[model samples]
Target: MDWDFLIDIFQQLLGGVPLTLQLSLLALVAGFILAVVIASAASSRYRLFRWIASAHIEIFRGTPLLVQVFLIYYGLGQIPGLRQSVLWPFLREPYWCAILALALNTSAYTAEIIRGAIQAVPASEIEAGRACGMSGLLLRRRVTWPIASIEQGQQGRCNSAVP
Candidate 1:
């Protein structure tokens, strides 16, 4: 019966679409980049790197997004010297604060996704790549990464949907 009122509400929601998309794209791109580094460290031979990466994944993933958002948006403002820092301008903006929070939160989940994808590649395949003289970055680029990335793409698409 209240078609006009419903239309007005829908129009109001539509006005936020641009900002929502902008926030999502920026956060996703940033989160993916961070995820790669984190996943690499998580897979590293070195214990310290592994520990750091594990801790990061746990802490970020374990905490609630709302708590993280509150910490970044409100907590950042409480830092004394932050006002004088070069990051002050960006940190002070609500948009940037939201982006940072989203990026950090998403990066943890993305890291886990990437780690699983990389692990899903068979060990024999890695050995074969080594046998073929594919080493280090080259092996990763041609073999492990190519295979794993397929999984990553699929999983990422699924994971990106909001709950």
Candidate 2:
């Protein structure tokens, strides 16, 4: 084996690290943001929100990632006016298409994790918070999520886990 040949191959692979990191980091951030919205909708009191969130999760999780990648990367151009729209520039790029596909794909799984965490919170804790006159966002912020977040931890349960 030639040492110089192996080094050249390593150099070529290392050169792509920045682009790979950019793609993965951007996809994870975008996916998490979308996942939070989807989870909230899934846990909502309204039926319409739940339905939409469920559909999004089901469709994205049920379908193949390759199929989604192909659809977003290639199908968008098929739309009559999309090619002429402002988003066309970004949509036409392979990097953006891959990121979008990855984000949507990850969002479905992340949303389910978030939803499961929320559901894992005990009803007694929620009742305790409500008894303290906490409700709505305040209840969720100060009480619900903290307990839920720490529920799976080995430390048992904590009212405020992180902060």
Candidate 3:
């Protein structure tokens, strides 16, 4: 084995750590927000919102991240109106494209995880919260969200090998 050559390549790769960390953190934050929105939509009473959220999750989850990146970075420019829009400047950049792809992909997975976690919360606990005068957003914020967060944490640890 070429130990010296391997070490040299590893050292070179280390130079990209800062950019990698930045992209990851950016994606994590954006994806979390997107996931929350999508999950909420999935759980909404409105059929349109549920359908749209389901479509977003299915489309992203079914496709490859590389294809998504290519589509956003190269294909978006091929569209007529988008190029003339205010977002064209940011969308044209590869860094933004990559971040968008990562955020989108992460959001799809995170949305499902969150949805499942929310569903897994016990009905008894929800009833208890209701008895305490918690309902709507307050019920979710005080009772449901914390349980779901814990569930997500455990699942995250178990599925750490994924991605």
Candidate 3 local lDDT, 17-118, one digit each (tens)? 999999999998999999999999999999999999999999999999999999999999999899999999999999999999999999999999999999
The TM-scores of all predictions, comma-separated, are 0.88, 0.88, 0.88
Off by over 4 Å in 1: 151-163
Look at candidate 2 and give me any clashing residue pairs: none
RMSD of each: 5.2, 4.9, 4.6
lDDT per residue, candidate 1, 36-153, as tens digits? 9999999999999999999989999999999999999999999989988999999999999999999999999999999999999989999999999989999999999998988767
Q: What are the lDDT figures for the candidates, one per model?
A: 0.94, 0.93, 0.95
Clashes of each: 0, 0, 0
Identify the runs in model 2 with alpha carbons over 4 angstroms from their true place. Answer: 152-163
